[model samples]
Target: MCSLLRSARALATTVSLAFIFNASSVLADVPQAYALTDIGSLGGYSVPHSIDESGRITGYSYTAGGIRAFSWTQSGGMINLGSLGNDKSMAYDSNEAGTVVGTSIVNGQYRGFIWNAASGMSAVPCPPAATCSARGINSQGVVTGYTQIPGGPYRPFRWSGGELLEYLPTLGGSQGYGAGINADGMVTGVSYTADPLPHAFVSNADTQLTDLGSIDGTTSYGKAINSQGHAVGYGADLGNKSAFFWSPELGMVPLGTLGGPNSYAKGINSADIVVGQSQTRTRATGFVWSAATGMLDLNEMLLGDTGYFITAALDINDAGQITAFGKDSYGRIRTLQLTPVY
Candidate 1:
């Protein structure tokens, strides 16, 4: 089970004026700077997972009873997407239509669920006695995640409004995990290959999985995919990990660390701007990366002194809005939203 615990802006323009002036491509839709806003929690603490182009954020927050899935908007604040007769629910992704997907406990079993303003919360179809999770949903409302029967390996699955679409093809291995879906119906995730090593994979229009090799390591994971089919994730070798960006033309390229041995890329927008966490010489910090700027410490791009030390960026929308998690001055984890300034 993925624990909720596991998962920037700007005076940024003035400092990166050189890179902005020398911009080589429009793919560098880099923000000049960002204004940060603390997205208040439900009660105890909140962890956000995905942000959509409309700036809608979905994730889980602690409540008086237990963890509950929620979606936050600028106008609506935090809207609880209650679970399916249980106290535990986690929302991992949302689409342009405001459809959210994640896992919920139903009758003591973890089952995938989909929620929208129209339908509210509904269970995603899965095989009998199978545990399922809905990790990502696309603009078209296609859902991607994983399912597993008792004593069997996890199998990546795709679903739509009503039924399970199909089990995604694997790289000849027994286990697979699907994380994100793009508007084109492409799914990005990790699969165990015949060699039994975990490898990142992306599905094509034909629904076939293609392995995206590692960043000089034996393991790779495709965490999220954009509408353009580009994917972002991390690769691991032994104990060291490196974040990477993958495109059909460029392949997988490691986004260098902030100055330390480990970095993890978790989110990317259509503009190719990447966001994640990297280890700095002194501490772990959030980062935003692109071909034009390489990588910039997100903490250094703040417009003013925020009492938060950003540690990981979870998602970025095409509008350049970012949802991230960090520690406040009191060392409590907090969820934040960053909006780009012109």
Candidate 2:
């Protein structure tokens, strides 16, 4: 994500965001089955990285000096979660009660931060001069992500209560990241397994980390986990990456791509519905999958003139709204929300 923001900041510009789902394209005045609304940027580019059940979004917006983290809501719109006296910050996840978490650049290094409406944005402490970021927060206010010491690989961490950063156990190697956390205080992320390969992991309330074996039994990285302990992610297998749905009952269920050999499962809702990106031989495609529906291309389901060629789905809410990154009618990348009308 840091790498992506760096590229977006370099290509930042004012893009006129406008498109029409007219009758000439698909249906007449039947109303859009899914409305794709642009979440405008603060300056350069705005990407909605994660969305909570309440439809609150948190991501980064590139500015003139640098990028800034932002929190957006239907009623409140976009609010810039300012940096820690620096020019860059990127938001990753928000939980119930409107608390946002991410990383902020402070004194030339990246550090974690928790943003709230009343208290504003404040730094969550770690080792001095370390690159750290918070990825997800649960309703219990526990923030999870990774922290890196100088010249060291990232180590997954948990911040709870006041100023205590707890490092979770690694599977074997020194690198790890906590990408998503559930209401049960379970965290899902990637950790190097015994083979020194990235594999999905889950942390219990006791901070005991469990390795959820990869599809290839060699490489995997977890993305999201629902309240029911079902985790979703991607794993390299047969020289190709594939999206997966993992649970205690079924283990890892592969979600094949749309005629391509690559797919990723980014976020999962309480209903076990998963959404993410997939390869289509030529370009990336957004996908939504479930036990009942399997894996289906989002663009195919979004009939009419939605004007969105979604390439990735970052998050999905319980109400079936998907926050995706895609190109507009003119091929400009935009953050859009697809709310099912039916």
Candidate 3:
């Protein structure tokens, strides 16, 4: 009787230990990426729109009454990049050299501005009677965006220092918007042609534009491009939008949602990691997608107010860091940063 009791006790102990070991191994396999921190506001609301390789961040913040552009450093605090003239300004994108570019409301009209440590904020000169906006700037100081031509349509423009050159014309529809540009001067955005369909397009350095048709049964829009000419954006899937990653080799590959039907791939880093937002069963959440890990929600990977609705990931860097915006329970906009736990 004593020997049987001892054997039963030992078997139970071994089973318990084996269970713990297996549980620990399963937990270890879970991805380690998570939200680093919330880039809090400057007395009001803040949203981080872009991050560079060095972990420098840029975006817009609303103060007591007006909006102001801001840049955040890894070690330094958030620094205000003041406006061109009026009370409203925004930093949409930044380059590796800390050069920031975006639009500013000056004298009651919108004008593009670029800022650097040396030059401060200066208006991107537009043609007489044209309103220009700079959307993206590459490391070489080349800016690409759009300008409204007098009595004509909005056309894409590229600025190298002081010279502003108009690139390929719009796809015959009335309007278009330039969203992103790469180091190679390749531009991507949405263009409306004769079919009245707003399709995504990629323009080469020589102004040759090619329309990257939507995933079957969807209308598409291009958001960002990386150095290797890969584009990331969203496309409607029979009325539901899903994030997409595109390259010359594979055309448009859908980055499916995180257990939901809607997803938007807002940014792509050089490593091909895509970041965006998706809809779960309960609410909207931000997600990072890679070939290795299918999709992960920012809220699940981070400890925070899980009730917040992550709206969009504006940009990501080579280090796998992401900058994004969302709405809190109070319906106010909030910015968040996610860092990879490698």
Where is model 2 poorest over a 10-residue stretch in terms of lDDT? 13-22
Between candidates 2 and 3, the lDDT winner: 2
Q: Across residues 95-162, which tens digit of lDDT does each residue of candidate 3 receive?
A: 87889999888777778889998979998877756777888888887888788867877777778886
Query: Can you give the TM-score per candidate against the true fold?
Result: 0.91, 0.87, 0.84
Full ranking by lDDT: 1, 2, 3
Model 3 residue 35 lDDT score: 48
Candidate 1 wrongly placed segments (more than 4 Å) = 1-24, 237-239
lDDT of each: 0.84, 0.80, 0.77
Q: Where does candidate 3 have its weakest 10-residue lDDT segment?
A: 21-30
The global Cα lDDT (0 to 1) of model 3 is: 0.77
Count steric clashes of candidate 1. Answer: 4
Candidate 3 regions with alpha-carbon error over 4 angstroms: 1-31, 303-311, 327-332
* Candidate with better TM-score, 2 vs 3: 2
Steric clash pairs (candidate 2): none
List clash counts for every candidate, in order: 4, 0, 0
lDDT of 2 by residue, 94-152 (tens): 98799999988877888888989999988888777788888999988988899998999
